[model samples]
Target: MTHEPSGLKIIDRFSISLVRCEKRPTSPFGCKVGLRSVIIHSVLLCSSFKKSRKYSDVGKLNKINFDSLKRPDYVRTLTIRCRHLSRKESNPAAGVFRDFRNLDRLEIDRCHLKSLPSALFSGLQNLYSLVVKNAKLSVIPLDLFAYTPNMMTLDLAGNELRIEPYALRSLRNLIHLDLSNNSIDFVTNTLISLTKLKVLTMDNNRLTNIDFRRLPKTLTDLSLRNNFITTIHYVSGSVRNLRRIDLSGNRLDFIAGSGSINMLPPSLRQIDLSNNQIAFIEDKSLAELKMLAVLNLKDNQLTELKVESLSGPENRLRLLLGRNPFKCHCGIRWLIHSTEKTYPVVLDLSELNCSSLLNDNQKLSLTVADQRNLLICQYDILCPTSCICCDKPVCSCRSSCPPKCRCYRSANMESAQKTRNVVMCEKMRFDGSEEIPDTITELQINSVQLEQWDIKKLQKLRALETIRISNTSITDDQANSLYSSRVLMELQLSSTNITKVPSNIGNLSQLILIDNPLTQLTNGDISVSEIFPQSLKLEKNQL
Candidate 1:
């Protein structure tokens, strides 16, 4: 055994030897002479020494003299961190690692390297894994790995390299390759050489297209997220072993069913198509994926998704349908009726919103139970320009004052019975050609312009019980027929052009005639009101 030099410490514990070559200013070139070489020969010669060496915070002068190492074949694993190597060597990386013939695993991190010499890895045929991450490498020479044909795993992520054809021809046994976070816009011919690749990740790149026919048939997991790809083309029998595929964050607008545009492999277990422009998925598009478990379709433009589209052999599928602008219609009945026995498990139902008949906008879960009556299959009955017609239970109706004058169902009113449906109109201009459904028991109108014929139509609502109109103009003749409703209990006529109160004003329980042009309230009006015993609101008037 050689004597230990200054700044070089040796620790032996439990058949494991650690040689640390730390900095010493007095030593030549800021490092102990023969520090790493001597440690390798002395410590590695032992029968119990581990074959792994880790160099931390390696400085410029603590250069690893690979040529001086006596037993390079004994070394198996080498990891270097924060070691900024100079680019001036004729064969920069080859000169550093050429002697480690028996090296199996090597990892270089945070080196800030911009380029690699053509003969960077010229003599490491036994290498199994190599990682060069967080560097500024722009290009990988086609023959860079010609000497390392047995390498199985190569991760060159976080670089600026644009892969070229035959760049990885030597890696025939590669199993996992990660080229994520790079500037490669096109890789049409770069991966055909890796025949045994199982997992490949090319995330956060500029790839615009992916031809699945060119992918290795042995692949099981492939992720191409955050790319510019508009469509994926997959020929039959290609990528048959693929189990998980992530094609999220793209511009895919539609997914056609089998025998159509894109045909997916049947062995897939997970498919992620979130955050795209997908508006439609053809019926049974993904039904063939019998083994699929997780289908993520969140953050898209889907208006309706059918349950049959997600059919599989088992009930293990979880459908992700959040952040989509789904319309409230019978087309979405599949989602509304999704159950454990009927369809796949749905996630984020509360995060989905839709425009429905009764409510313009509401959470999808709120309308699921009442979807049968709320979601109309088609718009057979057209409403006026500013009106919306919704189906409600035949419950008694309540009227709200402007500017929110929408009608709603109320069964707790003092003088009401749940008899017929109601249609509340706001800012409506009736043309008399339109027929209000005869099933309404209450009619509330705000900012409505009603004609003479329109009044005749309302006068015949046999179930009419409440009449509330505001911000309108009415004549004495119109008032006569309006206040003459036999079943009317409450009447409100505010902000109107009426000059006189109806002769039968006292017939109602509640009267709101404010904001009118009445100049005089005749004695008959007050005396009739006092005798009939009603609630009156006559504010904002001239009387």
Candidate 2:
């Protein structure tokens, strides 16, 4: 017997067992043994598994015939490569890989195949894994995997496949399936037949929404990152075994939840909702997510987070709350207290910042154990006289002649929709120095004296919507600027001295101008002809 450095070259008098080449073989290699029993028991894998080979320009072989090799059934693993050729010349004949009956693993790279026959993987009853990547395969036949029922892993990533439903129904025992980097748009009931599937990945697709109830119940890890998904729906007990779900880089505007009915599955342990457009989270949204351990809400549009919004299981949830425009108020002190306690620790606590309107619109850095007392509620400093303001739904002064304003316990404006605070100052006058709270939505000022009304302060109210300024003279400039508010919907200027309507009414749904001393609606270029409101009340105004 003699050995060479290039590869193993066995030369015996009775038989020739195998001839394996190292890298870039210049000639054909073969294996032949004297006895059939020796061929079945000895020569196992006689080819390079993952090596690159460049074909010579002389022979220019386009395909391989495993039948010509001695003891082809003894080969346990095989890797075929088609390099340096046009896409049209790289396709191999159908059933060319059927001779290796005992193959355990097979990989075909850069084959540029457009489709596969129904019986392409026939007779490979012992195959455990198969990988066909970087090919042009678009449509897979329904019965493609009928003969490979024992296959455990199937990876067809980097292909052009838009899989049809029941395309892989024959592989009941498939454990992991990676269909990433494809053009699949919808996957409704596409993978429900894989009863034993554990992990599934469909990243970088064109998926816009997903229903988890149609997925296989045995799946544990699911990743649908980098898609156009806007909403996800999953009922309880639908995906009972799912643990981790990654939905990063999507267009989700809010986490799906209501009072008690939410879209969270009970068995989820970790959820990644980072880099989305989530601006609101419903109260008790996470109450049913008892097994959750990690929650990521970074780089979103959240203005504030309520304590009830984060109330769910007793588990210490690890949070990621960085890069959000949080409003620095007393409502966010719960999060600061949680961070100070070090239970349910924020992973990116140092990267958090909040903007304060009372502090001259400055950005406040949020460090651990800092800014605990700096947060204040809207009514704590700007409450009106003879009116009690508390962070509850009902105030004690509501039984008086004038209705008292209610303060929302939550921080943000959208938190308490049903119980918004409405400040009422009837039959009173302000000294043009007292400021209204920014948290109030509706302001009712009746019979008040105001010759120096601040127009800038009215525009700075982020949540102000309805204004009822009665029995006060409204200057033309102030009236024009007030009508130009982007957020105001209803403006009641009843009994106020006004002559002309502002040209820039700006999408107001309702406009009231009753009992005003006006003869003709004209102010320079201001024309009331173009004004169109859904409901306009001009009963007592002079025309």
Identify the leading candidate in terms of TM-score: 1
Worst 10 residues of 2 by lDDT: 28-37
Which candidate wins on lDDT?
A: 2
- Could you estimate the TM-score for every candidate? 0.66, 0.64
Candidate 1 error regions (>4 Å): 1-59, 62-64, 67-70, 83-95, 258-263, 312-316, 339-342, 355-452, 459-543
Tens-digit lDDT track of model 2 for 74-152: 6666665555443543434556557778777777766677667778788888888888877767888788888888998
User: Mind giving the per-residue lDDT tens digits that candidate 1 earns over 98-199?
Assistant: 777777887766566656766777778888999877666777877888888899999988878776336677789999999988887886755766789999
Alpha carbon lDDT at 209, candidate 2: 84
* Residue pair clashes in candidate 2: none
Estimate the TM-score for candidate 2. Answer: 0.64
